[model samples]
Target: MPRKGIALVISAPSGAGKTTLVQRLLREFPQFGYSISCTTRQPRQGEVDGKDYVFLSREEFEQRRAQGYFAEWAEVHGNLYGTPLAPVKDSLQRGQDVLFDIDVQGAAQLKLSLAEAVFIFILPPSMTELERRLRSRALDDEATIERRMANARQEMLESRWYDALVINDDLDTAYDALRSVFVAASLAPFRSPDLPEALLDS
Candidate 1:
């Protein structure tokens, strides 16, 4: 029997290595596909439409919002970001899981709409370590880094809402844990009822 596709949401503060872990998971697990989000923010260097993000003007974004196009949408730092409903529904209908790398707000919204969504919160070892990792990147100024740290605290507090928590102290170990989660979710009786029959045949 074909089951609904699972919506796997991954949330983490900047520099928590969540992005790297998700990339690795996609590479390792071909059964899952990343959901490209639409955003009103201007694309950074090297970001391409439909690949990095579905870049849109504020007017376009607002139009879609009015039309009820988003499953979940939020404004962060004055930029609008939203997950399109069509692709996600289509993927699930086809039995392909969709991975969403979104912020806490979006994750919460998604959970309300997709009751079966699997939420995963990623965290650094410690706040001190998180700061070190953010600064080491040298991408943001001190003020920006400080803001991110503050946001990280808030995000951490909300981690309890997630279905799973991954401490990215070691990338390989964290990846393994995430893989195990996907494997288990896929094999769950509710997700795949055919498992019992297959096991019996084997």
Candidate 2:
């Protein structure tokens, strides 16, 4: 029988290398399921519905939230974003580990709801490096960059609560550390819920 899968919830600041690490993890572990969140925000350019996000109207989002459909939900800059509980549960039942790429706020909410999940926080090498990386993107204005920097500081402060912290100074080193974390979590006794019973039966 297939073993129960895990929820690997990872959070990082905007400028951190969270996305890159997640992409590498998925590429390395193709069996892992990527968690697609639901959002009330309008689709951005080139963002496909259901793939990028399960776009919902305010009314539809509220209705589902009222019915406890979301595993975790949070509002950011006036837009609602949530992870649907049903899909995650289905993924777990099928023995496919689910990966969650979420912000610190959503990560906090997820901890409360999904206490069994393995939470990891990614951090930049330093504030200076983080600022440099953010500016390198040229995706945000000065004001937005400053705001994100402030947010990053706050998020790092909260990272203390996570199960693991990976300082993304070197891409290969960070990825190795992250992979180690996942490997350890996967091997944890609790994760193999069926092992003891199976061995006892034999």
Candidate 3:
């Protein structure tokens, strides 16, 4: 039998840079599929449908949710976002690992379903650095930045629950560390069903 694919579930606080890491991973390893999500928000500039997200109307999103189309769904800031079941299921069935840049809650639910998944958590170098990154974005108000920093503190506490953790102090160093994780996990001893037989033969 072929070696089964692994699920790479990565979660991070808002300013931890997991999203950037995941994007780089996909670009470097074209064989891996990045899980494209469905969202009820309008697409941003230069974002493509089905690639960036499966943009949906509120009614369509809710209708599909009712029809059991999504593997996971969550509402954020009054917008609904979800991961559709088909792409992920198809990728795994074809022995291709799927990478996800989801939040702590989504990662938890995914683990319950994809028990064999390798869960990873990304952390900022420090709370000070996290606040700095958040503020640097200039996208949120001061109150919002403070709220995110507070949430990051709580989310950082959950890092211990993951199988692997990487601190993004420097992008180059962090990417190297993240790449090593995927490479190691893919070839882990437990992944091969023929390990015992091969060992006996050797």
* lDDT by candidate, in order shown: 0.88, 0.90, 0.85
How well is each residue in 52-135 modelled by candidate 1, as lDDT tens digits?
999999999999989988989998889998989888888887888998888898899888877778889999999999999999
The candidate that achieves the highest lDDT relative to the unseen native structure: 2
Clashing pairs in 1: none
lDDT of 3 by residue, 44-153 (tens): 99999989999999999999989978877899999999998777877876778888778888887787667778888899999988888888889899999988888888
Clashes per prediction?
0, 0, 0
Minimal lDDT window, size 10, model 1: 186-195
TM-score of each: 0.84, 0.89, 0.79
Model 1 clashes, total count: 0
User: Runs in model 1 with CA error above 4 Å?
Assistant: 1-3, 41-60, 193-202
* Higher-TM-score candidate of 2 and 3: 2
**Between candidates 1 and 3, the lDDT winner:** 1
Candidate 3: Cα lDDT at 10? 85
Higher-ranked by lDDT: 2 or 3: 2
- Scored against the true structure, residue 51 in model 1 reaches a CA lDDT of 98
